[model samples]
Target chain A: MARHLQDTIYKYVTMCLSGVALALIFIIIGVLIDSSYPALVVYGSKFFTSITWNAELTGSICYTSGIAHMCGATFGVLVYLTGTLLSSGIALLIGAPAAVGLAIVLAEIAPRRLASPISFVMELMAGIPSVIYGFWGILVLVPYLKSTLEVGLSHSLSSVPIFSGAVFSAGLLASGLILALMITPIIASISRDAMRQTPEGLKEAGRALGLTDWEITYKVVLPYARTSIIGSIALGLGRALGETMAVALVCGGASNFLPKTFFYPINTMAAFIVFQLDAAFTDPSGMSISVLAEMALLLMAITMIVNVVARLLVRRGFVSRPENLIQV
Target chain B: MEPDREPTNSVQLQDSFSFEGPVRPRNYTRRKALNLFVKGLLIVAAVLVLYPVVDILYLFAYKGLQVISISRLIETTAGAASFNPHAAGGLANAILGTLFIVGLSSMIAVPLGVFGGVYLAEFSNDNRFSSIVRFFADVLAGVPSIILGYVGFLVLVLRFNLGYSALGAAIVLSVLMFPYTVRATELALKRVPNGIKEGALALGSSKTTIINRLSLKFALPGILTGILLSLSISVGETAPLLYTAGFSDYINWTACCHTQIGYLTYVVFTFYTIPTTNAIDLSYLATFLLILIVLVINIVARVGLRRLSRDLESRI
Candidate 1:
């Protein structure tokens, strides 16, 4: 009887407390949506699209009842999000093969001595703070790119797209480069593990078929590990999309319009919000723009969607979809 | 991280050779060519990734050592004007402010996160409660420091009347660090032996007692490593600090929050733009210091974790 009581109490305590944590998600959404009801009701979907982020410079004045002002701001986020995608995409391109190759080396070709150091370095890269990367982007990569390739590339691609000018921090190219560097390790790490976990028998079957090394890898190994690669890429997207400090530092703060040219400076929504919103966050009903909060909601929603998708795809379905791994 | 996909190449190479005589030489040449090509690609990629990082670290260390030698690293930035070659004073104030604020935040974050993790891991399993916690922690983890800056401005700055103070910055840092702590603690707790809990319960120990005594003790090393890692990260964060801590000029000796305190990251971020040699030197020193502090703490964390993992293995 006493034991039963203890078990009952344990169950009760566990049930109540465990639910509390998951409940935080609802709470944050509830509070965010609840608190912003005033703005949401006033703006509706206009919050997502309206442009100019005109914050009343002097005190929280109620006179500025213009939602049209934030059109630039809404467009600013889209531009920055695009920049995020481009940079992370480049990283995926560079890192995907390298990561897979490294995994191959470690699992198959490596002499066991080098694997630990390689893994440690990758973790270190991931662990290093974003601010440090920002510092490096400005001080190191910017100068190097300018000195080595900018002049030549500018002359050659003056008429073409994206690479038409000096490699500076204010454009989509540098911002993308920085974001790419940040996520390479992520994709590489995931792809490496997934590929390594391929069943031994799968490879043996390929061997029996007399397939070449390249064919076996392309046909059998990559196919087996495709879902994990997809998951990693998705996760990488989330990181690139939301990265603030590093992107802010490199992305020149211009929320006026999308970069008509890659060389021209542009501002991402996150960068613009960080740079100006704080200094002007106090006014009446739609007076001093609370677009920062609105932006945060959007970023949060994006993260949630990406994370949910990654997790769902990586469920048991990942294991079951061995044949359709690439589709994942 | 290097992906583990190269095994397929080797597997294919060995498999193809076992087939026959005629195709053997052709398969061998193709694979050898592919191997060479892949090796070349790996070399290029590694260099591309490694260069910028190494160059930045090289510049910081080369420049920073001169200043550190002249005035000493942490002891004094006072006689820094005349004694130090060209730089303005030392990083004393920024270092102090960073340590204090991050220290304060870690104190708050580590406990909240650990308890939250324990609640999820032990009581809730990875169920609705755990999943929700995980989601919030994740969203909170990724919810841009800039957004959290808005939270600090809204809640602490105006609503709580804290304004831009060290305490406010610390509060914001704590919030940002919360998700990491919870994630780390949950990971650490997951590494704990289930048998420990079962054994304690068999002896009639209360669930709370077992959680606090047995599981926590087992996971303490990992938890400590998590806390230190989180603290190191907080110390390096500048965005949330930018919004909450504001900025200060003079070295602040007091623990008061009415006035802002100088931090290395803020100095580095802001001063890097100004076209002054002093500003440039100061920025370099700040970046170097920021990197140094994180490196030391991270090394300590890795060492601690290694030792703890060994200890746990021995106990098992």
Candidate 2:
């Protein structure tokens, strides 16, 4: 009886302690609301759409910031997002095949000794922080990009809008390339795992049919891992959205009036939040900060939904299917 | 029942890829070229990520090695310059302040984060609390550091009467790290199998004993990994500390409210723009020292984790 009581107490203690995460959320939201109340109540929904943020001209602290001025910031965000998509997409196009090939090389073709180090490198890539990636971008990629883009932009018939300008070192292209390098690990990792989940019997059957090494990778293994590869891309997409320091450092901070040339200066939503929110905190213009919050809320929503879906897909995705491969 | 022994039904995991015929060209040269191109491409990627970390390290060692070696680098503070080559004191105070702030943040955050994760993993079994916690962790992970610092300035530094002490910075960091701790903890805990708990229960051990002695022990290496990752992360964080920690002229010897501790990052940011030659040189040295300190700490912790994991694995 005493043991049972003790057990109940422990469970209660553990369970209650778990509420700490919930408490944190409430606290953060509560504080944001409490601090930003001057703006939230006055503007309400319009606060999100409003753009410009000077407080001196407006009679109230809670001036309705028009979306027109923020167009540059908004455009900055869009350009950065597009940059993210393109780079990440290119990375997938390049990485997925390589990952599938590497999986084949590691699983099907490689000698026993080679697999672990390759696998380790893939994980280590994921572990490298964004700051490190930015450092690399500043040192090597920037100089290379300047020369490379200048040459590409010079010889242009299709250079009408975003592509017309000179390819400066610190614009969308740099951001995209950096983002691509960062997300490659996520895509490669998940895809490699997905391929590994291919049932041994399927590969054996492919070999039995006199399929070459390449044939096994393309025909038998890849199809088996398709759902997982898509799932990995989704996970990588989540990381790309929330990426800070690296993108902020690389993306030119001059908020060009909504993306102009591909090489025009821009900022990501994450970068904008990092760059502006500090000065805004002191005697801050009300609706501007709220709107930033709304953007943050949006970014948070996208990241969470995608990640949860990714987690669900990546973790239990195979379980629903009757025939499974790599149980892990 | 064997773990992977569930009986298969008619449903297949996925469709097999169609290989009706060889539509791909029979050009061996193209295939070889394509493969080589891809290998080079990935190698470039490796270089793209590797070079900057190397550069920052290079700059830190090259320019600052002079100041760092004077042996006074860690001992002095930025007193009014009059000495040869401008001796702007040592990083002793910055080091102490950073340690103090980071330590307090860890002390507050780790227990809360670990418990939240444990609760989600062990108790809830994918209940509402667990789902909410997971979602919050994801969202929190993406919240920008500067915003958190801004938020911290408004809330803790202003409202809480903490007044930008080491405690305030620590609290903000603790909050910043909460999400990672929760995520890492949940992951580590989830990896613990059910059988271990069941066996302990069967042995007449209480649930607390099973949790403390069995489960936590098993989960230690993973928790350590998570904490190490957190520590490494906090080391580079500048913005949150910028707002909450503030600038301490002194070494924060007593960890008091009146004196906010000076951190290496602020000095780097502030000193770089100063008009005086002495201040700029001082800032350069500070940047170098900051990079060195972070690198050393990160590598040492990582090495420690690798050793600990190996030791644990061997014992098991």
Candidate 3:
């Protein structure tokens, strides 16, 4: 009887502990919504549509819908929203193809001797901290882009509107490139695992049809792993969207303005929160912080949607090995 | 064979099957060329993907080595007001503070996470509650760290009135780490074979005894790997800690609440753009240290864990 009772107690205790993980998600969402309510009430639709984001820190206090803010303060996240989407979009565009190609090499072409070392390197890359990536962006990538890529693009593509702007050292282009480098390992590693999971029987069937090695991979393995590859890309996109410090350092900290060109300055929602919170703290009305919370809410929602989609797409009855579930 | 059906098209089937002079397919060369081109592209892609890793390591090592010294490892960071080129202090405070915060958070997160994982793997067995827990843990993992930081600032620092304390930072870090640990533990426990449990049960051992004496032991290395991976993550995190931990120049060992703590990543983030060369150098040094620590943790988790798991499997 005592032994049975002990089992019951242990099970209940573990279940309650598990509940903590579930509770955290709700608590985060609730806290964000509760804090951002003031900004939500005041800004309403303009929050999504307008381009203005002046905190008006020195201006007289006023109330909109009983929420206090500086007289001229307005919060519009269109610029930040655009920055986040465009930068991540750029990262996806560059990273996905390279990642797929690298995955193909790792899954199909590379000898076992070569593959392990490369994988270890990729793991190290994934483990490198975001701030270090940001630091590297500041010291190396930004300057290199400014001197070589931006100059070359502006000169060679002078007639193209997006490509032909006054080039800056840090902006959308650099942020996108940095994010690309950061997320490549993630996408490549996941896609490589998925591609490797393509059944041996399927490859044998392709070979029996006299397909070349490359043909076998492209026709059989890639098709087999299509959903998983897409899922991995979505995962990568989710990561790029939420990347903060690296984008913060290299995105040129644009505010109240949209990016005009590839080289134009921009700011992501995640980066904006980090950059703006200091100034937000100074706003006596406390609405500025609420606006930042709203931005965080938006970021959370976007990433969650992407993650949900990834989960759905990646969960198509494939028996995912535990080791393949590398932390994203 | 000759008359299975009427001849399908203009050309007779017999004539189509007649032996050709060489029997070369028209698109063979094209296919081969396409395959070769793609193979080349794949190789190039692999190289391009790998180049940045090398570049980052080389850059950090070349720059960080110049600034890194024994004194820098032992001294506390100097205040910005005392700005000087030659006399800037080290990151001893940040290092100790990082250890303290990560250690404290680990203490809070590990047992809860492990127990949570056990519930999912051993007890709940795909019930609605466990599924909800699993889904939310995944979603939590995907949530942005900066968003976590904002929430941490709002709830812990402001509402709880922890006031930018180490305890606040540790709580936030533990939250960031909780999902990883839970997932890892669940996966590890699930990997334990059911046959052993059945055998133990047939022998009249209780479920609790089997779990305590058998399964958890087998899954120990995996659980440790998870903890180590999360530890590495928390070590390098800057965003959440920026507000919750709040920076300090000196190490405060006694106060866990309402006192700011220093950390390495903050040094890299804030000091890099400072005008003084010393500040920049310190930043590089911090980056170097962070990279070193993170890499070592990752290697141990990935490589060492694999070997240990293999040894355990062999023994079993």
Candidate 4:
């Protein structure tokens, strides 16, 4: 009787413990759908396509119960959604190659004694909070970009459409710069692991053939770590896509139009929600709150797909070794 | 220099690639120049990685250090004049609020994360349900922190009427922290040698006894590292706490689920936007404190993981 009782208790406890993981999925879906139901019902698919976000219908009633006012016909997230993609895509473009080079330098080129300390510093960089990055972007990066880089670019690249617009201190470019800096550590660390796992035999074989050190690294090591490097870039992409506070602070909070140029101010979906959420709670219109929730749902779906795909890519050949899993 | 030792398989390829006449005395100077160029690029990359860390530290030290004092550490934001960086008030409430929320969250998350990890690692035998659980855990971890805050706003704040409290904020932070804990603990448990578990089983030990008594003890250091990593993540969070914790000017020692609480990230997010020198200084101070907490946590995690690996190496 005692043994049976103990077995039952153990089974119950473990099952319940594992249930927590499953519960998270349900909660995310439930909250998003339940809170955003009114928008789902009212806007249907137009919420994704329409660009206007005029949620300030002074006397309209919200479909969600218990709200006196709400967004009338013109609510949508097309602009913010585009802003999120534009910044993250540009950030990945700028960050991935630099990160790969840094990873190679740390893993193969730098002397062993110097390499470990640099690796530690990169990890420390990763640990800094997103808000702090935003703060730095505002005070330091923005001014520098405005007074130096943007001015230089405007003068040199004025014929280019993207650089023709009047440069703002904070905008898509600023957001992307901050994101590039933020994601460098994640990409570098993961790719370093990939590089470290390359067989020593191949490197030695290259060396024996009178190949230069750089040539051995380029031809033998990099090709071997290609998939892992791609996986790390994907991992970095996921982080950049979902980054909130830092992007929010630097993206200049402009929600009006899709950004036509890199220097034009824009607002990401995450930033829109963060900037508007406080007013959302107190606003007479419940529609704005639900619309934000719907935006959250969209953001959640995207990040989930990116992360899951990235993990699968990272896990494909390294199934037996769990240590290679990307920490992000 | 010895062409005679060339492998038969590579002789034809080498002949085609090399200069036609007597292997043209391998250009030593060109190889040296290429190597130097590559080394220069590597040095540039290293500098690129180090530049931001130095920038943030230098700026914070110059700006944030000037205004920080004992009062700033201990006094509540209440009763202080707004926009005055030199006000007699401090972030004592925000400090306490952060500690309270993070502490309660760790208490809830650590046990649940550990048990879930054990299930994934020790039990389940890679069954379908456990696989699903693991998949969702990964998915949950990838969900943006702001989205989690929105969820918290809907469920805890609006639906449950929890009223922007530390309890609600902690719950949101736990959800954010949960996957890291699970992954870390699971990885740690996997690190325990299979031989040890088999030895225990042969001695007539129950599976529970082996897991709780033997395996957990062995994996404790890695698990602790994971917990600290999660805590650091929780400490640095801003979005989730935005709507869930709200903000209070004063410390509220009321029920955990009732009072709106202040956090350092909140100050960093809100204060710098204000146009006052004092406000900007306060934001910088809060930013410095936040960076300090995360740096310490990350350092501890790294040291703990290194020690755990060393322990594993010794056992081998």
- Can you give the DockQ of every candidate in the order shown? 0.24, 0.20, 0.69, 0.52
The per-prediction tally of clashing pairs is: 22, 12, 0, 2
Selected candidate, larger TM-score, 1 vs 4 = 4
Error of 3 at B47 (Å): 0.9
lDDT, candidates in the order shown? 0.64, 0.61, 0.87, 0.81
lDDT of 1 by residue, A1-328 (tens): 6756865676566455434445545655654554455456445576555444444344332322443232222222455555455555655665556556655554544456876666556655666677778877777666655676555677888887766645554556567678777776666666666776789898888877665655677788878878877777776777776677787777766554556555555566556666764445444434234545666667667766886666544433222211111112
lDDT of each residue in A27-116, candidate 3, tens digit only: 999999999999888888889998988988888899887778888787899999999999999999999999889889999999999999
Task: Give interface RMSD, per candidate.
Answer: 6.1, 6.4, 1.4, 2.6
For model 3, the DockQ equals 0.69
- Give stretches of model 3 more than 4 Å off: A316-323, B1-26, B79-83
CAPRI class assigned to model 4: medium
Worst 10 residues of 3 chain A by lDDT: A316-325
Which prediction has more favorable DockQ, 3 or 4?
Answer: 3
For each candidate, give its TM-score against the true structure: 0.82, 0.75, 0.95, 0.92
Which parts of model 2 are misplaced by more than 4 Å? A29-136, A155-160, A167-169, A281-291, A316-328, B1-67, B70-72, B75-90, B120-139, B142-147, B158-163, B186-203, B253-260, B264-316
Highest TM-score model number: 3
Docking class of 3: medium
Worst 10 residues of 1 chain A by lDDT: A319-328
Sorted on lDDT, highest at the top, how do the candidates line up? 3, 4, 1, 2
Which of the two, 1 or 2, has more TM-score?
1
When summed lDDT is taken over every stretch of 10 residues in candidate 1 chain B, the lowest stretch is: B75-84
